[model samples]
Target: MTLPMQVPIPGLPARVRIHEVGPRDGLQNEKATVPTAVKADFVRRLAEAGLTTVEATSFVHPEWVPQLADAEELFPQVAALPVALPVLVPNERGLDRALALGARRVAVFASATESFAKANLNRTVDESLAMFAPVVARAKAAGVHVRGYLSMCFGDPWEGAVPVPRVVRVCRALLDLGCDELSLGDTIGVATPGHVTALLDELTGQGVPVDAVGVHFHDTYGQALANTLAALQRGVTTVDASAGGLGGCPFAKSATGNLATEDLVWMLRGLGVETGVDLDRLVATSVWMAAHLNRPSPSRTVRALSPTHHQEQ
Candidate 1:
């Protein structure tokens, strides 16, 4: 396998935490149901590959996301892993399911645009926040860390160009509700580097600390890595990525897959920014997963570095 030459960039963090979301966010969008056993192995592989934080699965009702219906069966399979495993809990009921299974970290999905809130959660922005408040509080009370995922932070399909202040207001609300961190999402993947800088600056201006912010960009416009670089330039260290570029928004037709972890790691490696991820092992893991899913990996780095790349070419 080949690797990028390490070159440190000025004004970027010395290390970044890659929040791997392949097992949950990635697989949830798949048309085929990935078996529970495979999902467990995927999580284990990610941990073994040095991803500290891996989102395991969602506790949402199975009818809504039939792909993650095995959250109950799957969490236990990898719960003993040394890495942090965060699960998505939509409401108190979902929180209950996760808590019962000993999930130490959970995430609540929010939308920066009303149109997306209505489409994804079937609630207005305020209503969805109201729904998450108790859940966040309960999770915190139980000594669990909570993450708030704010979707459509950059652009929305129905309501184009989401205002920065609107996103800050919701960020404040989620933080006030006891969320430890917020993952700002470009749900439609329309964000450019300038747009990313503007949002991060506005969030800081509105009193949201940069350390509590994470960027989750989709590759719809092929700007995820550029947007991520911008976020890093602004001192945002946590990033959300999926192995093999595995996920997209189910409710948002314009959305593409999440930023590929392999690609992100490759970039960070070249930048001499430590992510603690073993590139070779990570690529192999994704290749193994691509085989399980019966599709080629969408990740550019994975395709370029995998053992079968020469044959595929």
Candidate 2:
């Protein structure tokens, strides 16, 4: 696919790996119960669009996230896809459900701020980490790759610009759990470039391998792409992006869509960075999803490139 435009960005990697989260993170916020088949097709289309790591679904309790209640049925449909399907497991029960359906990769989420931990997970920071310790271990022992997600790593709504050390503590605990990687999240989309650098610096000082780190940014303040560039310059390889810029934290009422995969791919392509994603197909998938939900996608790249993006009313 041809790129929309190009602008030189210094100190960027030649290639970046985008961990597609639209299927889970993006759709969970939607009130509509997306059909199980639609979710499966979304993942499959993401793979066809050249996204290798599509987060397929979450194994959270149905009461908590009704959209993902079909995890049991969802996994079997996409289990054989030639891509990494990592499901979010809130605890051992979630892991059990994932494992039963042949899930080979899983993710555990924790909050850097105590307030968010209490609000989102109904547990304190330590309690959440303690719960994940054995889940990570047993999952690893079962040969499943585990990823740790530390939310509010940059700034928390209740706490305001979070302290690096506080975020680091959660990161260390996750690392201790033998997580294959850590996906630091800017849950409120308040992070700036400086915060991104400082956090990565501190994480490195604490002996956390930079290579084992990824970033998840929200576009609430329209800083997701700028912050993404900051992380990329700091050697972060994995980035979490939602197709058509879909989804936000249910807890963060003010937050917006994630850094759009289309926008990121557009910027990376301009910098001559290889993502291996078919931008045209990716936008098409997002467009199809938007139609299903009776809305236009929020992605700038999708809007700019779509032939019928803004149809005459």
Top lDDT model: 1
Candidate 2 lDDT, 1-313, residue by residue in tens: 4565767677888789999999999999997889999989999999999999999999999999998889898899999999999999999999998899899999999999999999989999999899999899999999999999999998877888899999998899899889999999999899999999999999999999988999999998889999999999888989999998999988777677899999999988888888999998999998888888777888888888885774721
> C-alpha displacement of 288 in model 1, angstroms?
0.5
**Candidate 1 lDDT by residue in tens digits, 1-313:** 6788887889999999999999999999999999999999999999999999999999999999999999999999999999999999999999999999999999999999999999999999999999998999899999999999999999999999988889989999999999999999999899999989998898898889999999999999899999999999999999999999999988998888999999999999999999999999999999889888888899999988875853543
Q: Please state every model's RMSD to the true fold in angstroms.
A: 1.2, 1.4
Best by TM-score: 1
lDDT of each: 0.94, 0.91
